[model samples]
Target: MTPELVRELIARGEALTLEFKGEERRQLSENDLVETVVCMANRPTQEMGYVLIGVEDDGRVTGARPRDAGGIDPLRIQALIANRTRPSLSCRVWVVELEGKPVLVIEVPRSCKDLCVRVRV
Candidate 1:
């Protein structure tokens, strides 16, 4: 995605329906990953969501996966989220190479039922 696109999402911050992480670069938190999947599994109609990683504030493209965060590991991550999240969160995780770096890309489609979001205590 372009810098402008990232800026737009960051500008909006967290949505009950969609959450975006602007800090803690290079690491995809378990919570963030789950939120994206839940959004797809039970998100509102006409809503498209995502969990964007490796994208800088300036819209610069960071690598696909960090040396510490292996590209192969994200595949495992996909399985982990699928296994644990209740009602099941089916989503696609792609390791995109941006500017010669690897970044995890997740796309979630809107869901009709089972609104998959709750405020974490």
Candidate 2:
């Protein structure tokens, strides 16, 4: 996504199709990330949903934690979401640099099937 779009989304604040996850204090867990994707995919009204990581709940941009030494891996995130969801969710993951910080953006498409978390247990 473009930096302008990211700024627009942040300014709009959280809504049914938008969610902001702050990673200021701690790293955002994978489980939480997957859960957010599932939640957004389930929303029928929106054609697409956005989850912004490294932003505070109050809309402050902090920065996303790198999954490894390389940095935040969009491919890994896409695979994780696909593998963890029951019908698998196809999402576009990318990092948008804003305010000199890296914000991880996950775009979730509307799912025709009811998407649920795939738990091994």
Candidate 3:
């Protein structure tokens, strides 16, 4: 997504379809991330859900450092979901620059199945 879109989401604040994760301060808990993905996927909406990393709950942008951004691997997230979630789910993860800061965006589509069970992290 573009920086403008990111800003818009931030302005809108967290909701059922959007979550902000401030990874610049601390690493995201694997269990929390897995559970959130499951919950968002199972939500009753046609639109996709978003997990915006490097953003705080209060709409602050801490930003993922360049080194840390390089380490934010989407494949690792996919593997975790594949192993832990029942019926399996796919997500698109990418890094977007916002005012010279890197933000990791994980986009999860609504599940076709009735539920997205989170078996484990």
lDDT of 3 by residue, 20-71 (tens): 8887667777776778788888888787799887898898888754333556
Highest-scoring model, lDDT: 2
Segments in model 3 whose C-alpha atoms lie over 4 Å from true places:
65-70
Q: What is the overall TM-score of model 3 with all chains considered together?
A: 0.80
Q: Write the per-residue lDDT of candidate 1 for residues 1-121, one digit (tens) a residue.
A: 5544544664665564445433335465667657556655565556677666666544455544452443446667677667767655556666655455555656666654645544243
Candidate 1, residue 30: lDDT? 68
Clash counts for all predictions? 7, 0, 0
Full candidate order by TM-score, most accurate first:
2, 3, 1
Candidate 3 achieves a global lDDT of 0.78
Candidate 3 residue pairs in clash (backbone atoms < 3 Å): none
- How would you encode candidate 2's per-residue C-alpha lDDT over 1-121 as one tens digit per residue? 8999999999999988999999999998898888888888877674578999999989999999888899988999999998888777789999999889999999988777544435222
Candidates in descending lDDT order: 2, 3, 1
